[model samples]
Target chain A: MSEIIVNAVSKTWGGVGGVDRISFKAEAGTLLVLLGPSGCGKSTTLRLIAGLEEVDSGTITIGGRDVTHLSPAERRISMVFQSYALFPHLNVAENIIFGLKVRGVGRAERDEKLRKVADIVGLSHLLERKPSQLSGGQRQRVALGRAIIAEAAVCLMDEPLSNLDAKLRHEMRTEIRALQQRLGMTMVYVTHDQSEAMTMADRVILMRDGHIEQNGAPHELYNEPASDFAARFIGTPPMNIISWQDGAMLGVRPEHIFVAERNGVPATVRAVEYLGADSIILCDVKGETVSVRQTGYCSLPAGTQVGLEWQNRHIHLFDRDSGKRLADRAPA
Target chain B: MVAAVMTAAEPKTARHRNWATNVNAWLLLLPAIVLLGMFTHYPILATLYHSFFSLGRSGPAEFVGLENYRYMLDDDVFWQVLRNNFIFALATVPTSIGLALLMAVWVDKKIVGRSFLRLAFFTPTVLPMIAVANIWLFFYTPDYGLLDQFLKSLGFAGHNWLGDPSTVMTCLAVMVVWKEAGFFMIFYLAALQSIPPELKEAASVEGASRWYFFRRVTFPLLMPTTLFISINALINSFKLVDQLVIMTKGGPNNASSLLLYYIYEVAFNFWDTTYAATLTVTLITILAAVALTKFVYLDRRIHYQ
Candidate 1:
C-alpha cells in the first residue's frame, strides 16, 4: 500500500502557529485535500509529509515504511510548490530531467523519459525554452512535469494552482485530477479555496487553527458537517447558521432554505446578488445575516419582508458555546 | 486663412519646444560629461599623444614616433614586469574567487555563530590596503616574524619569505588573495540569498543530494555574479599596487614588481615621462579589453535573473 498515514503529527515553531496533533490517512490513488484558510497549518502538514519539515511528535509512514526521520530524498516522494520553483537558468527539458540526472540515469533513458513526460504534460513543443520565456500556465505545466517525472507513489502539492487565473485554475484543476487518477498517485493537495477542495478532492480534511475540524469525502463534509466551523467552511454561500434558543445554533444549507408565502421564520430581504446561473438572496432574520441560494434570478428587492422555510430533516443543531453538532434534529 | 496660418506656425512652435527639451537634457547631463572628460578622457588622450613623442629634457619635446615603443620592447625589466603581472593575475584571481564562494556558502547557512563568522570574514575587506600590507609585513619579517617563529618551533629552518626572490611573488600573491577574497564574498552571499528557498525544497523532494543540487542549480544560477566578480578581480589584479610600495618595494631585483609599480618607477623615479605614457597606454588597453570582453561576450553567456 502506497497510502500516506500521518499519525498524530504535531509541529510548532517557538510555541506559535503550527499544526497540532493532526492525523489523517490518504489512501493510495486517492486525492486528499487539506483545506483551510491561511495560517491554518495546511501547508505545514504537507511539508511535514514531504519531509521538508520534521514532525515534532508522532510517526509518519509512507507505503507502510516509517519515514519520520528519513531525509526528504529517502522518503520517496515528490512535491510541487505554489511558486512552481522551476530553475530559471535551465530549459524546460533540463528542469524536468534534473532529478533523473541526479540519480545517475543514463543519457538515453533520460531523453526517453523526458520525451514521454514532455508529451504527457503537453510541453513537447516548448522543451528548449527557459522558464522566464514560458507563460504562467506553461511554467505550471513544467512544474507538474517535474513532479510526475519522478513517478513517486505519493505526490504532495501545496496550492499549486493558486498562482493561476480563475479560468486557468479551473482548467488545471480538472487536468490535475485526471492526471492523478491516470497515474494512480496518492496526492495530498493543499488549498485555501473551498471550491477547489469541493470539486477536486476524493477526501477533504478541513482544518481550523492547526486542528482537523472535519475529515471525510467532499460530499460527506458538505452534507453532514461535524461542527459549525465545517458547516460554514464547506459550501459556497456556505451553510446558513443563525442563533437559536436555549444556547444552541440552527444550521441549514442555503439550498435547503426557501422563501415562503406564510407560516415560516419571518425575515427582511436585505440585498440580492444575481449570478448568471443562480442568485443569492441575503436576508436579515432577527438581527443576524443569512443568505438563501435560489436558482436563476432573485428579483426580491431590499427591505422586502419574506418568510424563510425549510424541512425538519434539513435542520441541524449545534451548541452555541462549543460549535459542535448536536445529534438530535429540531422539531418540525 | 487663419486656420492655415495656425497650422503652418504649429511646426515652428513644435521645433522650438524640441530645441528647449534638447537643451534641458544637455544641461542635466553637463556635470557628469564635463567631469569625465576633464579627468578621464583628457588624461587618456594626453597619454596617447605623449606616448609617440620624446621627453624634452634639455629642449622642446619633438616627435619620436615608435621610439618609446621600440625601447619598451627591448627593455628586459618591462618584459619581466609584464610577465610577472600575468602570473600574479593568474595566481590570485581564481584562488580568491573560489575561497570567496566557499566562505559565502558557509556563512549563508543557519549554523552557530553565523553573524560572527560573517563579520570575521568581512573584517579583512574593511581594512585599508596599506594597513593590511603592514600587518603582513610584520608576519613575513625574516627571523623573528610570526611565520618564521612558527617554522622554528616546528624544527624547520627560518627562511626569508618576502626578501627571497623565489618566494616573493608567491608571498605577495597570497597576501593579495587574503585581502581580496572577503570583498568578493559579499557579492556571492547576496546572490546565494536571492535564490528562493522553494527551489532547494523542490530539489530535495526529487531525491537530489545537497551537492548535486548545488552543482546543477545553485552554481548555474550564480553565473552572472561570478562573471561580474571575476572581471572586477582581474582588473583589480592589474590596478592594486599600494601594498607593493609598503612590503616588497619591487625588491631584490624586481621579482615581485607588477606592471603598475614598474610604470610608477619609470614615470616618477627614472623621469621618462613619455615612456611612462607609453606604459600607461598599454595598461589602459589591457583594462579596456577586459571590460569589453565582459560586455561583448561573457554577458551573453551568463544567465541574469
Candidate 2:
C-alpha cells in the first residue's frame, strides 16, 4: 500500500553512534525486516521511519509524500512498540479504536473497524478486558489490533515479538505475516533474532555497527550472504569459521562441515553434542577448532580421530581483512 | 517418604545459621521496632488516656466525661475556627494540587532550562515557612508592599492584603500554594517520570491528539498519584499556620486561622487546657480520616509491570 523511500537518511546522536548514512527503499506492501544484534541502531532507524525519531539529515518519503518534518501522528502510519505500549487504562476494544476515535471517526465506523480488527487479531471475546488482565500473547494481539484498526498504509513494528515466549513468538509471527500479506500493508519490522526476520521478512536488511552489511531476500542473505557478518549471523548453530594463512576466513554452515570419508582433511574430534536428531562434532586440526554436524546422534566419542571435509559447493569464503564474501573471487 | 523427610530436614540445617544470621535479622529490625514504640505506640496510648480527662498543670487530671466535647460543640469561636479550617483546606488542597500538576507537566516538557524552572517551582518549599511569611508580609503591605507598588504604578492603590477580610483568605491561599506546590510537584514529577515514554509515543502512533492523550491516557494514569498527593496536601493545609502568626494573627477577623492555629490559641493563648485537648482530638480525627482515605485508594494501586 505504501512505498517507503529513505534518501540519504542519517541519524547520528552527535558523538557516540546511531544509524549513520542509512539509505534504502522498500516497495509497496512488501515486508522489510531490519535485522541486527541489540544496539546496532536498527530500532532507531525504524523509529526514524515511523517519525518517532528525528533524523539528523536527509528525507523520508512514503507513498510519494515527503514526511521528514512531520510528527508521528501526522505520518498516517502506526507503530507496534517493543513493549506493545497498550494503554493499560483503556480496555481492549477502546485500545483498538483509540486511533479512529482520535481522528474524529464516527462511532459506527469505529465500532465496525474495531470489530473487524478484533476479529482479525482473534481478540473478539477479550474486548472488555483491560490490558493488565490479558496474557502476554493476548496483549500483543491487542497491540496489533490497534495498528490494524488505523488501516495506515505502513506499519512499523519494533521487535514486537521479543516479549513473548518462544512458542508464542513463532505462532504470532505466522499470524502477523499472514495478516500483513492478506492486507498488503507495508511493514518494517526490527529484530535481533535472525530466525524471526528470516521467517517473516520478504527481504532482510542485515545491519552491523550502524551500517547495512547486506540487504537481500532471506534465502539470498542466507544461502549467498554478501559478507562474513551475514554468513555468521544467519545460521542457527552459527557458521563455523577457520582462519587460513594470509588471513582468508573459511566460513561454512555447521551442517556443511560434516564428517566425510572422501579425501578428507586430518582432524581429531574434540567433543560431540548429542542433539536428538543430529549430533554436532567439535573437532581440532593444527591447533584450530571447527564444528561439524553429522546426521543422527552417533556415538562419536572424544579423542576419536576424524577426517573433516565439506561440500565444495557449500563452503563460503570470506576475505581476510574486509570480511566481505569472496563469492566470485573465492580461492580454488 | 524418605526423600520428602530428607527435603524437610534440609531446611532445618539452613535455619540453624549459628546465631550470626539471627543476630543480623534482629539488628535490622531493632531500630524500626524501637522507633515505632517510642513514636507511634506511646503517642496513641497517651492520646487515648489524655482524651478521657483534662490535663492540669501540677495536678492529677479529673475525668471530664463529655464536657469537653459538649463545650466544643457550643463554642462560637470553635465553630468559626472549624469553618475557617475547612475553608483553608478547601482553598489550599485543590488549588495547590491543581497548580502543582500544571507546573509539573509544564516543567516536565522539554523547556529550556527545565531544571531552573523546576528550581523556581520548588524554591518556596525549601524556604522556612516563617521566612516565607516574612517575604509575603512585605509583599502584602497595603501602602508600601510590592502589590501596592505595582498597583500604584497602574494608577490604583492596592487594598490591605492581610488586613482586608475579603482578600485575606485568598492571600493565605496564594501563600500556601507558593509554599506547597513545589513539594507536591516532586510527587507528580516522580509519577510523570515513572510513566513509560512509550505510552505517549504509542498514543501518538494511534493518532491521539494531545487532549485525548491526556484525558484518556495521562490523567487516568495520574489519578492514584493525584489522590495520594491531595490527601497529603489536605492534612498539611489544616495543620501549618506560620503565616497566621506573622501576617494575620488569625485576624483581621480570624479569617486565616487553621485548626492547628486555633488549637494553639486555645491551649497557649487562652490558657484553656481541657478544651484545647478536645480540639486536638478533632485535629487527630481529621488527620486520621485523610490518612485512611489515602491508604484505601492509593496503596492498593501500586503499578504492576
Candidate 3:
C-alpha cells in the first residue's frame, strides 16, 4: 500500500522558496530518503508532509485519505526531528508517552506500547532520565521511541542524526535501519550525507534547487546518475568532473580511471593524495584537473606521467548548454 | 643573584610600562567605579548610619544602637504594611507574568491590524505609571466613572471600586497588570525571538497539536525567562506606590498602604524622624533582598552551547 502520496506539492517562502511542485510516494513499510545539500528543500518537503508547513499548492493523501488541510494531530503520522526536540523537563518515559496521553490512549495500552518502543530502541534502563541527562545518541533513541509508540502509519525523520558526532551517527543509523525493518514502518528520512543516504535508504530522492533531480535505489543512483548533479552528489568525494572543451561534460568516478602504461592516450599527474586503500591522482589533462581513484597504486608522486584509459561505454556525456545527461554520446 | 634579579625585573622602563598598563586598565573601569559609588555604596552607608540612631529635635542625631530596629519589630502598623506588601508581590507577580505571556503570543502571531494592536498593547508601558494611575482613578470612581455608567446601562447595580475594602487590592492588581504586562511582554518577545523556529516546526510535525506543542516544548524552554520576569514583577510591585498615593492615599483608611509609601509618610509627614529612619531601614532591607536574587540569577543563568 502507498501510505503517503505527495501530489504536486510545493511550498514557497515569501522571498526565497523551498520545494517546488515535488511529488513522490512511499510504499507502506519502505524507507524513502529525501537527500540533498542544506537549503535544497529536503527538510521543507518533510515539513510539508508533517503538516508543519502548509503547501502553497497540491494535495497529500495518507492512508488513502486527503489530509492536505488537516492538522498534525489529525494526521496519523509521526515525525522525529533533527535536534530530537526532547522535552527537557520530561523524563524519557514521559516524553515517549506525551503524544499518546494527549490522544487519550488508555494508560495500560500506552505503557505497553512505550515498553515495546523502549525495548526496540534499547532505552529501558534510562526511562527516568531527562533529555539533558542523556547523551546525544541516547536522546536520538528516545526521539525514535517517541515516534514509534505513536504507531502511526508512517514515520518522518528530518536530519535526526546530524546532531550526533560522526561515529555515533554511523552506529545509530544502523540501529534505526534495523528497528525500521523489524517494525516494517513506512519512513521518509531527510539527510545531506551521501554515505548515510546510500546506506540507510531503500530509495533515495536526490534533490537540487527545490526539485527532485533523480530518485531510485542507492546503487541505481550511483551507477546511473541521471545528470551531472546526481553523479557529483551521490558518491563520496563526489564523481570527478573535468571541464572538457567542444561539447563534452566529462565525468569519471575516481576508481574508474587507471594509470596504465598504455600508448596513444594523454595525461599528466598534477597532485597525488596518498590514501591507504586508494590514492587520489589529480592529473592535468590539458588544463583541467582530473581526479582518478588509483586503487593499489598509492605512493605515486606528483608529476608522474600516466596514460588515462577507460571503457568508452562506461563514460557519461552531458549536453554542456543544458547540463542534461546524454544517454548516448555523439560518435567519438 | 644580581643577574637573576635583573632578569626578573627586566628593566626600569619595563616597570614603567607595567605601571602604565595598570593605569590604562583603571581608566577603562572609571565609569563603573563612579556609577557604583554614586548609585550603591554612598546611599548604603548613609542608610546604615541612620537606621541605628534616634532623631532628636532640630539637633545632631542621637546614636541609639538597634533602637529603631526593635521599634520596627513591635509597631502594629509596620507589621500590617509588611503583610500587605507581601500579598501585593504575590498577587501582581503571577498575574503580570501570565498576562505578559498571553500578550506576547497574541502579538507574535501578527493578528489582524498587528502593528496597530502591538502599539496599543505597548502604549501603557510608555506612559508614566503615575499617569496610568490617574486614568484608572477616574475609571474606579463610584458614581460618575465609565465603569459604573456601563454597569448601570447593562441593568446591574453600580458599586464603589477603590472605596470598597474587599475590592481595593483587586483594583490595584488589575491596574498594575495593565501597566506592566506589555513591558514584560517585550522581554518575552526577545526570548521568543531567540527560540529556533525549527523547534516549533519539529513539534508541529510530531503529531502534537498547538496547545500540546506549547505545553510540552515551548513552556519548559521558556522557564528561565519566566523566572526572570517573575523577579522583575516582584520588584516593580514594591516600587510602585504612586497609585496608592493618588487614587487611594493608602485610604479609605490606609487599606492600600504599601511599604515604600508608608516609609515616606513616617519619615516626612509625621516628622517622627527616628521612626522614619527605622522605616527606611526596613524598606532598604526588603529591596536589597530582591536585588540580591536578581544579581545572583542574572550572573549565572546563561547556559552556553
**DockQ in order:** 0.81, 0.58, 0.36
TM-score of each: 0.97, 0.90, 0.84
Tens digit of per-residue lDDT, candidate 3, span A114-142: 88889988999999998888999999999
lDDT tens digits by residue: candidate 2, B1-305: 99888868787676677567989999999999999989988876676566668766669788878877887889888888888889888888998898999999999899899999999899988999999999999998988999899999999967888888888898888988889999999889988898899999998877678888888888888887888788788888887888888888998777767778988988798887667777888888888987986678666764433
Query: Which regions of candidate 3 are displaced past 4 Å?
Result: A14-16, A108-111, A241-248, A262-264, A328-331, B1-52, B58-76, B83-87, B134-172, B244-248, B285-305
Worst 10 residues of 3 chain B by lDDT: B296-305
lDDT of each: 0.94, 0.86, 0.83
What tens digits encode model 3's per-residue C-alpha lDDT throughout B182-261? 89998887777777776676566555677877876677667778877887788888888988878987876667788888
Under CAPRI classification, how is model 1 graded? high
Q: Lowest-lDDT window of 10 residues in candidate 1 chain A?
A: A323-332
Q: How much is the lDDT of residue A159 in candidate 2?
A: 94
**Given the true complex, what DockQ would model 3 score?**
0.36
Top-down lDDT ranking: 1, 2, 3
Lowest-lDDT window of 10 residues in candidate 2 chain A?
A323-332
Off by over 4 Å in 2: A245-247, A327-331, B1-65, B296-305
- Model 1 stretches with alpha carbons more than 4 Å out: B1-9
- Measured with C-alpha atoms, the lDDT of residue A323 in candidate 1 is 97
